[model samples]
Target: MAGIPHYYLYGEPGAGVDRDLLHIEPVRDRSGPNDWRIRPHAHPDHMQVMLVADGGGTIRMEDRTLAVPSPGVLVIPAGIVHQIDFDPGTDGHVITAALPCLAAAGAQDPALGRAAGQAAAYPLDGSGVDVAAAIEAFRSLQREFLWAAPGRRAAIIAQFSRILVLILRLSLIHRAPAIGAADHDLLVRYRALVEAQFRSHHPPAHYAALLAVTPARLNAACKARAGRTASDILHDRLVVEAKRYLIYTESSVAQVAHLTGFEDPAYFNRFFTRRVGCAPGAFRRQAAES
Candidate 1:
């Protein structure tokens, strides 16, 4: 499959830059000359935060387009296809940070890592401090990133983490049927485990053992946080990877099956059919045609 352009911020695609670094700027700086519109694109391993002070527009994420008004925040997680159009004269600060930076900062705290993985957009509450703090955080980041003074990089990274904390707090405050801390943590752990072991086709019990939790407890957490069981989570992850392979590669069905952890093509076909509502070949054909 064809690849989307990769860049360090809004600069030219494929520019050589440190993978663990970040770029900070105002939305107007980049969007002004381009009619305030950005076409759909994917960032391979970068995360973005935008603090809009006034004005608004729409966002395109995958197959959905969302209306976004000003006085809000936008969090774009890594690897998602997204695009944004700013209203003319919109005012905002955009903070683009490398995923590795957040990962390193959160190495000892799984909750922080989990927060960095969320993608969302919503208007800030009028009486809340989140919007103000978020805007100032990005401004500080931009100054530190540009000044290159003593410990500039360290200061910028610290500001990045601080911004993430504020955003996560805001998310919790605004999300409905708020997730309990324990349930959120468990779901994050499950997602991380799935990322590491989905290729192995490990059972839910295996994941629970690795997490040092009982399978029943894990299932409870998944059901509480996501309305799905742990087993369903694992199966869904497997099917997602399988669909990606089938759509993006020239691999045959058997090859795709093996690559996605099914050694038996027939079994893989059935699994895909059950979860994805179609056979693998048919899925591939439909995706290609679309």
Candidate 2:
């Protein structure tokens, strides 16, 4: 871990590695317009779980975008390209964790499948209240663990498991029985590809070449099904990961710049502030204090 690069740690065993027994959960309500409408992006090795507390919108993936109504939740697996646009009038909470944590929770645990593979991505039908309750409890525990104790990792995992199970109980969408398995598989694969490559090569053409499809064709599929352009998804994906690295790692701004594929750390700093409303270091300092 000491010698291996962090990029290789994408879902690997090192810093930010997924934990079966440790989860840092957050809770926010009416938090103003912040971290909402997360850009399209992918996690090379982590999965994200989110619940819609109010309103309705759409969630775009590599191959398809699904309509999301309030009282719903979602599980996004690692290595997928996707983005969420909350209903302009809606507010919600999101829980993101590494996939290794999901897997470590035994495959048989309903939450694992609800958050690990295809069956797990879209789980919210009308469970917003429950999701909110679980998240509230999770957040409470997180705050307590942070301020009061040093060894509550076990308790955190147990509580998080309850949250996942609540998410899994929501009724799933019944997509047509006609969508061929191959197409479904392709959709999943395309998302995974975007997750792994969005940071480096962002053009749809580059991705189409990897997928062995024409850029135009890929664009059509993404637009028609996912409700957005491939370029949009690609850029959003890159930015989110960049934000995570900037906020969570102790690496210097220059180093975060390099890790995010920026040729110049100064330019990266400018870009980060422009989009995020603050300089990378400033945001890091503020987040640390919070």
Candidate 3:
């Protein structure tokens, strides 16, 4: 009960995954080492990486306290309530990526999120880069993000993906499912379009019009292969995106409400609350206050 964090979920997400990358922040919290006991936290759509830089600490994952030290990487799956804080004399750095994006890139294929368990937090390349180098790299990327460097954003994304590959190779013993070459080009095209427009327009019909597929046929293909309706997939993606924004961003509830395509703040409040069981402001406040 010493150093756990808190999390808040935003919606009842449907099956099928969405890829949205979020904030890459670095924590060098020596000051809060004594005062920073994060209560157990959970979010429905996020997995995180905790890289320690200094001071050793205890991480309570579900019902356990795994010892974490500098140059150590802790992988936490989304939807599990866990907490981490100073073990006694250690301060550390953590890098958190949205689960959807890591799920898309980390594996040799997609679907790793559902398959890969929490143990995926071990070394990157047999634990890549040793502890010291990885810490430097993580810090470098965090610094670049803070600077808001011009072309560095894309570079950081690439580096982050590469880091995930290393973690996957070491952590998951199973190979990923392959995407075969078949008559699914149109479906692939539709998926790409949906990824780009999910935050702006989540209506499956909007994507169906873009892909020149009748709504019925689109739904059939999606449900058959992905076991989800096209509209459900769209909402799942949008909800995941909204959660990412809320967690990693300092944006206000109203700003987040508008950015996620909600026209009325009241409507957004009702929408997310209906699914997640809490108001938007309450979610943000709880997330920040933690």
- Local distance difference test, each candidate: 0.73, 0.56, 0.57
Q: List the lowest-lDDT window of 10 residues for candidate 2.
A: 1-10
Q: What is candidate 3's lDDT per residue for 118-186, written digit by digit as tens?
A: 433343333434555666666766776567567764666666665564455545542322222221334
For model 1 the local lDDT of residue 134 reads 66
The runs of at least 3 residues in candidate 3 whose Cα sits more than 4 Å from the true structure, single-residue gaps closed, are: 1-19, 30-34, 107-117, 120-129, 169-234, 238-290
TM-score of each: 0.59, 0.46, 0.50
Better of 1 and 2 by lDDT: 1
TM-score result, candidate 2: 0.46
Of the candidates shown, which would achieve the greatest TM-score relative to the real structure?
1
- Candidate that scores best on lDDT: 1
Cα-lDDT of candidate 2 = 0.56
Can you give the lDDT of residue 203 in candidate 3? 76
